[model samples]
Target: MSRLYSDIFTNRASTGQASADLSEAHPKFAVNKVDFWYPGKQALYNISLTIPERSVVAFIGPSGCGKSTLLRVLNRMNDLIDGTRHTGDVNLDGKNIFAPEVNLVDLRRRVGMVFQKSNPFPKSIYENVVFGPRVAGQRDRARLDYLVERCLKQSALWNEVKDRLHTSALALSGGQQQRLCIARALATDPEVLLMDEPASALDPKSTNAIEDLIFELKKDYTIVIVTHNMQQAARVSDVTAFFFEGKLVESGLTEKIFTRPTQRQTEDYITGRFG
Candidate 1:
C-alpha cells in the first residue's frame, strides 16, 4: 500500500474532536487494486479502500470521478450493465467476492443497496418491506409480520406508516418512499448498506431526515454512501474517500480528510477551488 493508503488506517486527527478514530475498527469490506471498465471506457483505476465495520464511509468527488461506480462495484451492481468488467478483488469480510464459488444472490442479501432514486414496487408498503424475505422462501405470516415492523422501525419509518401498511407505496412522499426503500433493504438483514446519492433528490428537510437516519443506522450496519454534498459527507461519515479521474486521491478520517487533506487535488476539490 502507498503512504496515502496507509494514512487511511491511521488516526492523525486529535482526540477531543467529535469524530472518533475508526482506524482500529474491524474491516467490513476491502477493495484491493480494483480497476473497472464500462463498454468503451474505464471508470476506476487501482482503487483500494478498507471500510470498517459498523461505521459510515462517504465517497465524495466531482461528476464522473468513479465514486458511484465504486459504490455499485461493492455489491457487484455493475454486473447488470452490458460490457462492464473489472480487475482485482473486492473482499467482504476477508473473502474474495469474485471467487467463482461465491453466490451472487447470497452476496447481495448480505450487501443490500439503495439507489439514487427511490424505487418502491407497485405493491403495498407492507409487501415492499417483506419482499426480500418472501422471495427467499419465507412463508410464515407471523415471522413476516415481525420483519415488517422491525425493519420499518430500523429505517425510522414505522410511526408514519404503521396504520397504513397495506396502502400502495407509491402514495407516500418522496422522502417516505426513500425510507421505505431503505426499510426494504434492511429487511434482508444485510451487514453492509450501500447507498448511491440516496438523499440528493429530496428537499432540505428530507435530506436532514435521511442524514439522521444514517447516523443512527451506523450503530448496526456498515454504510457506504456516494454523495456530492461535502457538508453531508462531513456531518455523517466516519471516513471520507475522495476520488479524481478514476483514482482514489486521498482517504482518511472524515475530519482529517476535510480539514487537513494531504493531497493537493483533494484540497482543491474540497475547497471549491476546482473539481
Candidate 2:
C-alpha cells in the first residue's frame, strides 16, 4: 500500500497517462514541500501539488485528513488561529503568499472561501450579496446593483431571488442560502475560490444546482474544493487528489482517479475498503 502511494510522487515523468506531471509544467498555485502544524500535532506532511489556472480541483478524504487544512492555507485563513505554523512554499502567480511583505487582507480578497454551512448574515439578501464590495468602498448604488445582479446571476440565484432582493437572507431555503453565500464570495471578484463542502447540506436538487454552478464558474476562476462526497468530487472536479493521515496518496484526472487510480490506497478508499 505504501509503495502504491510512493509511485505517484517518485515517477514524475509523463507516460501519456492522465496523471502526468503538472506540478512544474504549469501551476497557478504551486505548493512545494508544505508542512503544517497546530501546536503539538502535525496536520499536513510534505505535501506538494500544482493547481492550474481556471480549473476545478477536488480534495477527497475522510474527516481529519487535512484536506480542509490545505484549502485554508491557499488564502492564509489559518493565520487567524493561534499556535499554527507552516513551512515551505505556496506560491500564487509565482509569488509566495506567506512572505512577510505579503498583505493578508489583500490575499484573502483575491482568494474567496465558502464554508460547509451556509452562513448568510441577518442582513437583506441584496445587502448580503453586496457586502464585500461595500467593504472595498464601492459606494456607487447603480454599480452595486449591477454587481449584485451579476454575482447572483452567476451563482444561479438571481432568478429565484430577484424579486425578493430586499428580503431577509435567512428566510431563504438552505440551498438558496448556500448559493447566496457563493454570490457573496463572488462579489469580491476573487481570482481563486476555495469551497469546503459547498453542497453537502443541500437536497439532491440543490446539490445538482451547485454542481452546475461549479461547472460554469470554473471558466472564470481557479477553484479548489474539499468535498467528502465521492460522487460530488467525481462529478464537479476536473482533477482529484486523495489525502489520508496528512499525506496525499494520489492525484489525477477525475475520470482516471475514479476508474483507474495508480495508488492502492486510492483504489481502496474509492472502493470503500476504508477511509
Alpha-carbon RMSD to native, per candidate: 5.0, 6.1
lDDT per residue for candidate 2 within 103-149, as digits (tens), equals: 98799999999999999999999999899999899999999999999
Highest-scoring model, TM-score: 1
Candidates in order, TM-scores: namely 0.93, 0.91
Error of 1 at 11 (Å): 20
Give the C-alpha miss distance for residue 48 in model 2, angstroms: 0.2
> Would you list the clashing residue pairs of candidate 1?
none
Best by lDDT: 1
Clashes of each: 0, 0
Model 2 spans with C-alpha error above 4 angstroms: 1-26
Give the lowest summed-lDDT range of ten residues in model 2.
11-20
